[model samples]
Target: MTTFASSLKKEIARVARKELKDELGALRKASASYRTEIAALKRQVRELQVALRQTSRRADKALHTVAPDAPAESPKRGRRAVFSAERFKAQRERLGLTQKDMAAYLGTSTLSVWKWETGQVTPRARFLPAILGLRTTGKREVLQQLARGAGGATD
Candidate 1:
């Protein structure tokens, strides 16, 4: 009876060891595969870093070679809008744009448009083109343009 009990215990221990070895073998294979992937990613990162450095150097060289006063550059126009006072007032009323709304569209402060409407000031030359562009649009179109925020009601 003692021999039988000892032999049973030995068998159980052997089976457990075999199961643990198989599980550990699978884990070791997975770990090696992950290590290989990580190494490849590291190599790719090095290549990209080298490419970025080369690109930045080339851009710097190109910038240096460019003429300091190239025609590629243009003088920045002043912020000026030139619209008739009566026309501005009439259009704002027609398009249903309040002083605040007009400022929003014209990219000016509400006080500016208010003063412009009251004949105390005028729209800047820069804002003239945009306001003129708005001339072609109707009230509904203007509403849609203002609604160009995010996913709008019309959207």
Candidate 2:
């Protein structure tokens, strides 16, 4: 009876040890899976931060162009203006002409010239030819083109 009891106790101890070993293996697998998930989350966070920065830059550019009250900074890269009111005004003034004189030369009203100078209005598509022609051919061809209904001149 003493030998049978001792053997039974040994069997129970062996079964408990095997169960504990299996539990430990399962815990280790869970821990490794959690670690992988954490690493993936960190990488996603970094990618989102980069996307946020790019979006912010584009927003800043859009705001600067649309808002006249925004602080003036140096021109951005790869931006070009086909026409500039300030440049036009400066060039006309340098040529010692008043708005009325320039308007008469360009075959437009003085009010239109004033609007162009003050940035209240921009040149129309039909007027672009006249403006460019004025710059190139000294305003004579501009009126001639308007008279002929050929509103724009070719480059």
Candidate 3:
């Protein structure tokens, strides 16, 4: 009887060891699956963060590309007078442009513009077409004509 009881106890112990090993193997497999899921979630989070950063940068660039508001300077009142030296001076004053700015637009020196305005010298006959072009069609047309070598006098 003692022998049979001892054998029975040994069998029960062996069965319990096998069951524990199987349960441990199942737990390890579940842990590995959870680890893979965590890695995938981390990758997704990183991709989302990168996309968000790109979107924010584009929005910031668009905001910067918009033009700023003009300052509080008032517009000049009354009709523009005729195109003369005095009128040109008044126009320059009203427009708040310097002689250098006008010269730059005319492709000449400020001194030349000053001489024309002061009546010490007249603009060349060729320059009249340019001036008329500037007056009628605007500066862009004058510049285009100058570039195309058709800016000077017809004669």
- RMSD to true structure for each model, in Å: 15.9, 11.4, 17.7
Candidate 1 — number of clashing residue pairs? 6
Q: What's the TM-score of each model vs. the native? A: 0.42, 0.37, 0.38
Question: Candidate 1 lDDT (Cα, whole model)?
Answer: 0.70
Query: Can you write out model 1's per-residue Cα lDDT over 44-73, one digit (the tens) per residue?
Result: 999999999999987654543334343322
Candidate 3 — worst ten consecutive residues by lDDT sum? 66-75
Global local distance difference test of model 2: 0.66
N/CA/C clash count, model 2: 0
Question: Where does candidate 2 have its weakest 10-residue lDDT segment?
Answer: 72-81
Candidate 2 per-residue lDDT over residues 50-79, each given as its tens digit: 999999987654432334343323223444
Candidate lDDT scores, in order, read 0.70, 0.66, 0.62
Candidate 3 on 1-155: residue-level lDDT in tens?
A: 99999999999999999999999999999999999999999999999999999999876544322223422221134422223455445545554557876666566778987976775555665555444344344545545655565633444
Model 3 spans > 4 angstroms off:
1-10, 67-155
**2 versus 3: better lDDT goes to:** 2
